[model samples]
Target: MAEMIKEPIENYGLSSKDRKKTLFSKIGIVGCGKEGSKIATVAATAGIEVVFLEISDDRIQQAFDRIGSELDMRIATWGLTESEKKTILGRIKGTLTFAAFKNCDFVIEAVRYDDNGERSLNHRKEIFHELENILAEDAIIATNASSVVITELASELKYKERCVCLHFVMMQPQSRILEIVRGLYTSDSCYNKVCQFAKLIGYDFVTVEESAGLISNRLFFILLNEACAILQEGLTTPIEIDSIIKVGLGQRQGVFCMADQMGIEKIVPQMEDLYKEFGSLKYKPSPLLLRLNRAKRWGVSTRIGFYEYDEEGNRIINENEKK
Candidate 1:
């Protein structure tokens, strides 16, 4: 696939006049997992008051620690002023209670995707119903669901018009693209506000219609699944498969390496769910993935996967390994 350079966010579907007029002050982020924590850190750094809510006390503390460490590293690596880092860190608050979200102008749900490999409409409805009881009447709700149908999730809520999918890539502060998926019932104001927020935070936004597995993940999983199948069929070694993609397709990383980075267990469940939902053979999980995940050999964090990481965090490939 060719790399398609995207138009600037300011030049996208939203108008500049509308962008300047949108409101964004207090924001709430639910789920302090990998992507959620990054979003909170970035939004806080952009001078938006941010409150992070997670299900458990442990997770909330983890988010706080992760954000603090990341900001400190960023300051040193990028030569950011100490005062600037202090201001950014000061703007963020972490909580385990939902009441903290009462004053938020916008809420972003970064919760786990359901067993269906999509943000279940029912799940969103449950949260929104509770939120409506506690939150201000007009607070907009956005989800960070990558593949779920946005319109479906929106329609399940009483405030359907104010709900949309604001899909951020894996690492929010580093990745350039942010997809604003407008649901069928999504209001123009909500859409424009999200577009404006994306621009303010230095991200390029693309407006996509409600679809299961929006552009990036849709294309990415299809390719990743194919690569898994090729490996499962014993057509080539993992190294050879990765080399082919990198050299022939101009990809920065190969499938096995990407899978290792993503965690084989994490992607397997989604692939299995997608296969069940879409009935596509391409969505089937590879046998190797199943075996590895079953063995609890999850990547980096677990210290084992396709390649072993040394004490210094270098990936050491096993030359004599063959299944």
Candidate 2:
């Protein structure tokens, strides 16, 4: 018998020529906490591969659990299918080392905020150094931090032109707006590429000056503070106030409800930062928020904030409201 003729693997299998080539194809996230995991899931759902780094295996697993739970909620609402969820989850990978980010052309640092809702600038600077050592010179570096000025972080890096800030207001998934801030040293090419990235992940982008709270948080925190003041004055309840905002102002949700979604712990600190930056009393965190933060009723993550939520994160309806 004649020997079998050699064949090209691409011909026998999927053709290499058919493979899609795109920038932002693979990205990395330095932290897999709440915001980090949300972006990871969103990117994976958009068909981009994601690699998220955590400090330990347990933390990585926790991030995975959180992402899965979010997808389950979408599935329950008919927004996602089981197979699509599987595919999205399959595209995300967790790691304990920055080395995993070496191949990522774009990496976002979405680390958890401390009790005060702030990440130490020194700590973030160190993270930038580690990423710079691993990634290519032209790779884009970004932070999902609304308060920290991108200019401050960029000043710490050798490739200062590659640094930018993307404040993702993840109050609701459908709230697909991204506040993209370019640092003083950020190059125009880097800014344009990041805009493309926002588009890739199915987000609309807004150019913002390097301010502590960008646009959304500045407006949101002030509105939330006023609502708290009204409650303190005994003028209205949270539910009633929410109704006014939703029905009257046409906001998708009330400020109190949106705050619960934002988590009290995260809210207080960011507000504190704004107050500290601008020295404005309006940006000061409300007493109610401080109490909630102290009590650790951190929104849906803890299943409670202004309202209570069930295991699936759905708010439990009060019996009185049932009438």
Candidate 3:
């Protein structure tokens, strides 16, 4: 299929007065990890200028390489052109500090997980405070957190109404829906602006209340936990289990496959956080997941999770799997 441009190409170099009328003309992404990079890519591809913050020069380059590689994937399928890739790259700038985000109209914090992919809530809170200092009072500040609540985080901000939570489902080619959470102090205008920005990026916004796990992740974790329990009982193999869900339940992808793609390391922390919040045994990270994480078998990124994957992120199948 040919590439689709949902709107007129934005002229990012317009004068300040003209730029002020543009919605989300400049986007800031804090911590260009997996989710952050995707958010940065989506904004830049949609003709918005994006400035992403990383901790060091090396990390900045790493983010650039990942984004470039992804764009190359689109180029391979003839969905994007080499020149278009360059233009997208040009729209995205990497910075080591929050100062570059000062002019950003909207800033989203997709803070990096630890080296082990474990989340640090305090670290995310610190990023929000730093963002508040760097951004204008009216600029929207968002967190790309699935299991973390936004209300407590926004409580520390001066313009608490500007704080919102945005969760982007990181599926391939990206999900068309954005899970948007409005905190207790989030203003109606602030929430409306974020919804408008989501539409600008070709996403349908699902307005959800402030809660741990929101809509997508909360429902997903429950299924993932159940899948883990079934697997633990040796009732079926991963392939067989996935096949049942794919064929019978009509799911595009099974729970284990989704978990693997999301990285076992990342899933554990989210499940743990959910468990802590709701005090539900169903939210507890499965022992099987814990074992895989401890073994450092983080899905496609690490080339192994519930199943093995090649460097190209394609699953490796045995010859018998062809049947």
List lDDT for all candidates, in order.
0.76, 0.89, 0.87
User: What would the C-alpha RMSD of candidate 2 be, to one decimal place?
Assistant: 3.9
On the 0 to 100 scale, the lDDT of residue 184 in model 2 is 97
Looking at model 2, the pairs that clash are none
The better candidate by lDDT, 1 or 2, is 2
lDDT of 2: 0.89
lDDT of 3 by residue, 1-323 (tens): 99977853456554454554577989999889888888988899999999999889999999999999989999999989999999999999999888999999899988877867766878889989999998888999999887778998888888999999988977435477898988899999999999899889888888888787788888888888888899999898888888888898987887788888888888888888888898999889989999998999889888998999998888999778887
Ranking by lDDT: 2, 3, 1
List ranges where model 2 is wrong by over 4 Å: 1-21
Expressed as tens digits, the lDDT of each residue in 1-323 for candidate 2 is: 99999977776657767664479989999999879998998899999999999999999999999999999989999999999999999999999999999889999999887766568889998999999999989899999988888898889688899999998887765688899999999999999999998898889989999888889989899899999899999997888999999899988888877888888888888888889899999999989889999999988878998889998777888986688
Error of 1 at 58 (Å): 2.3
Candidate maximizing TM-score? 2
Error of 2 at 45 (Å): 1.3
In candidate 3, the residue pairs with backbone N, CA or C atoms under 3 Å apart (3 or more residues apart, or in different chains) clash, namely: none
Q: On TM-score, who's better, 1 or 2?
A: 2
**TM-score quality measure for candidate 3:** 0.90
Clashes of each: 1, 0, 0
**Clash count (model 3, backbone only):** 0
